[model samples]
Target: MKKILLFLLAISSPILSISQNSTTSQIDETFKAYTGWFVDAIFYEIPFSDTFQIPWVLIVLIGGAVFFTIYFKLINFTGFLTAIQVVRGKYEDIEKHGVDNLYGEDAIVEDILKANQEDELNVAGDQTPGGDNIETIRDESADGEVSHFQALTAALSATVGLGNIAGVAVALSIGGPGATFWMIVAGLLGMASKFAECTLGVKYRDVGADGTVYGGPMYYLTKGLKEKGAGGLGKVLAVLFAIFVVGGSFGGGNMFQANQAAAQFTKLFELTGENSGLYFGIVMAALVAVVIIGGIKRIASVTEKVVPFMAGIYVLAALVILFANFSLIDDAFGLIFEGAFSGLGIAGGLIGVMIQGIRRGAFSNEAGVGSAAIAHSAVRTKYPASEGIVALLEPFVDTVVICTMTALVIIITNFNGQFMEYGVEIKEGVELTAVAFDSVIPHFSIVLTIAVILFAFSTMISWSYYGMQGWKFLFGKGKITDLVYKVLFLLFVIVGASISLGAVIDFSDAMIFAMVVPNIIGVVMLSPIVKKELTKYMNAIKKKEIAIEEGAGDLNDQL
Candidate 1:
């Protein structure tokens, strides 16, 4: 294993070295060429169906959230508090109530372990009929596998990357401050979608013989639909989600992440020249190779630490910007509100702003995309519903909180110059954000550089986990299987940097939307189950219910 990894690194080193030495002009040219192709694809290559009012993915994502909101009686809103408690282990007994009966009242230590070993196949394993278990991950995760805080952070790492800093900048530029208002609105409503999908993720997750837990929209769509006597529908949706998830894992999740990171590295370090992205891509591929080679444990470990620190630093910087422009905050909010509803002539009018807000915001948090469920499914819990409650926090934090802070910085920075006037086309990313920050603090570009890099790194690690899971979903689980995916994932990191990936990214973004088509259907169809789980978990938490000696067997860590 070490030799193979070493050989791959040896071959990639020169590619990284050469690309890093490329000139800035070359990078820009490459980027433009790629962007041009993407534009063409959207206008000419894509099927006529996509020319509709809004992309179909955005519709299912937002539409599904709305449906679940009504059907589940807004559990995301009502159960928010309980979710906190559940994650805190407040409902341990209620959760333990449903464990298998193999371990009776007098079951000994050996008996308990033996019983759990039998139940292990459901804990996420190499025997999931398809998915492989790489790295021999023990289902009984070590103490630091991923705490509730770590889990949240791990998931957060994936959601709060370039999307918040770079993506928000673009949205505000194209859609106007009014778009910010709708972004928040989208974030709020997305909470419900996060809850419904995550709940089902836990309910239908497949635990493996190795004790590792594997669960996601794929598991729930197939399992939940089948339980509802819609086996055909479930199977189709599950397959569709798995296929799209794989594409998403590769394109939006992996390559895009690498592409952004390579760009950040080049800009921040002042590495100038052509094929610079390729060189950085090589470096990124190498680093990612190391982490991803370890699979989920390594990915979770790094993200748990990186996510919170990066977020804290970014948020603190934004707070400073907000404090500097305290008076203009109201005006900014006003602009967001008025622009969202009234159309500032900047966003293609009201309809355009709404679509931009929903599309960007949903992409940012990934509420209905079902990716979060993949991460949450690993949380240690007996009840499939417990983690769902905890999962609701993701969107609120990602879009509502993180994205909001970013918007404020950009909005307040434009207090005098007019945010809507600045067009979306920017030569350098660090500059767009630096321009925003330097409004208050001079030479703040350095700080923005650091923030972007950290944000990119955290995001890269988390997405690695998401992609690995998707890889396992299709390929069988095992160490060799995982290594193959990680290596390929790393190679893409290099590819993303070296070449213009407009076509690849567009296809991936489309694939991400396509995920919503099937995943939302699954969540919507079984929203009732989500409601039931919500009620059950809440009732148990409220009553502080548990058996003194009744809660049997250890719950799989996080699943």
Candidate 2:
């Protein structure tokens, strides 16, 4: 790890020199000149009529989500309680013992008995049960790395960042309060999309020789589609998804996060200097490097702690502002509902409002974008659908809960129309959100700044793992490949912080959303497989309940 860090610094020194020679503004202009066309091309909107244009990517994301919701019989709603139970370890015994063991399958039962017999011998005096013979016993839950809760947090860390804080502000500003209503609707529908892809992520995952799990759209698109006799198509989609993920991880995941965190931190502290960003970048990069170098287990461990803490702080702050303006709570919801359908002040009326809400919600939660599936695939579970069920909660938490909190705060604060004008796009979304927070609570922008930094830090570490997985898929997995990816990732953090490259960030954002194309296509194609896995997991849960009930009856009779 020391050598790797040294190598990263060594490689980044030249780029750092180049950035130093040119002013930050110069770099921004140069990057925009070079990448403007790419950004425009990727974000090209499809026109249904002269007055209405929608980005094709948003169409794919929302359409896929709606399809999944209906096809799964609204699993998002029906499976909500079950998802909580799974994360809480309600089905741990079934997951650990394998479904076959619950039905008293002779082969599995015999292995358990044999393992117990071997434990009785203890010839080598190994006190641990089964000792050297333990490998003979199959633990169904041992395949993956992290627990269901850890994977949820890791994925949540990636999605619940700047988008909830800044992006929601932008959406509500343009579409008025109506956008918030549609955003929640989009979030609820998106739950099914997350369930489908994550299930496939686990179903078609590749477990390495050393038991490291490699799973995501890349794996499932290739392996899942091949099972359905579309190997050629699957391989192409997988490669495309992998390339997009790596690019997205670098720009949107790593650099953009560092850049925003640095901006918010420096501005709040009144640190105005050419090198302030560079200095903050180094510190931020160093902190991120420590967490990411430990790989997924370390990443998961850090995120499970950071995500909850940061989210709790941000949510609590929002709650304070909400309760303070309790009188306006009804009015805020009234605006949201009225604006959603009436679209009185928004451009293009109801269509414009619906588009803004759905677009922001889809982008925020990233439900069908396929990135969350990469993180969810790492969960330790024998039943793929168990993790998939848990994954449905991500969009709910990110968009429905957190984003809603942000919107309500913005709406209630804007009752006097002092902060922003309706129907106008707000460029400085973070600042606008901060103003809303600071209005009711004195000096609350300081807390908002801290939350932004935490959001950026947690986001960077999780995305590092996502990008590395894609890197390994393209280049063979090895120590060198891992080192190279990490070095580049860390370097991007500095570059992102030191320079403001709007065009570059826009391109990366496009790459991130571009992922929706291949992912939605592949997941829809493999929906049947997800359904089968869901059925298999549900049956196991039912069987476990029946067994428990029968045992209780026998004990009652004896008593």
Candidate with best TM-score = 2
Give lDDT tens digits, candidate 2, residues 1-559. Answer: 5544564475345445446546656666666655577678778899988767999888889999999999999999999999999998888656655755644434254565555466555635766642433212222235777889999999999999999999999998899999999999999999999999999998888887555778899999999899999999999999899888988998999889999999999999999998999999999999999998888888898999999999999999999999999999999999999999999978979999999999999999999989999998988778999999999999999999999999999999999899898899989899999999999888999999999999999999999988998888887678988988988899899888988866668878988988999999999999999999999999988876776676622111111
Clashing pairs in 2: none
Which runs in model 1 stand beyond 4 Å of their true positions? 1-52, 88-145, 418-430, 545-559
Compared with the true structure, all predictions reach lDDT values of: 0.70, 0.86
* 423: Cα error in model 2, Å: 0.9
Minimum summed lDDT over a 10-residue window in model 2 is located at 132-141
Report per-prediction Cα RMSD to one decimal.
Answer: 7.3, 4.8
Residue-wise C-alpha lDDT for candidate 1, range 22-78, written one tens digit per residue = 554554454444344533433232133332267555666777778777777777688
Could you estimate the TM-score for every candidate? 0.80, 0.91
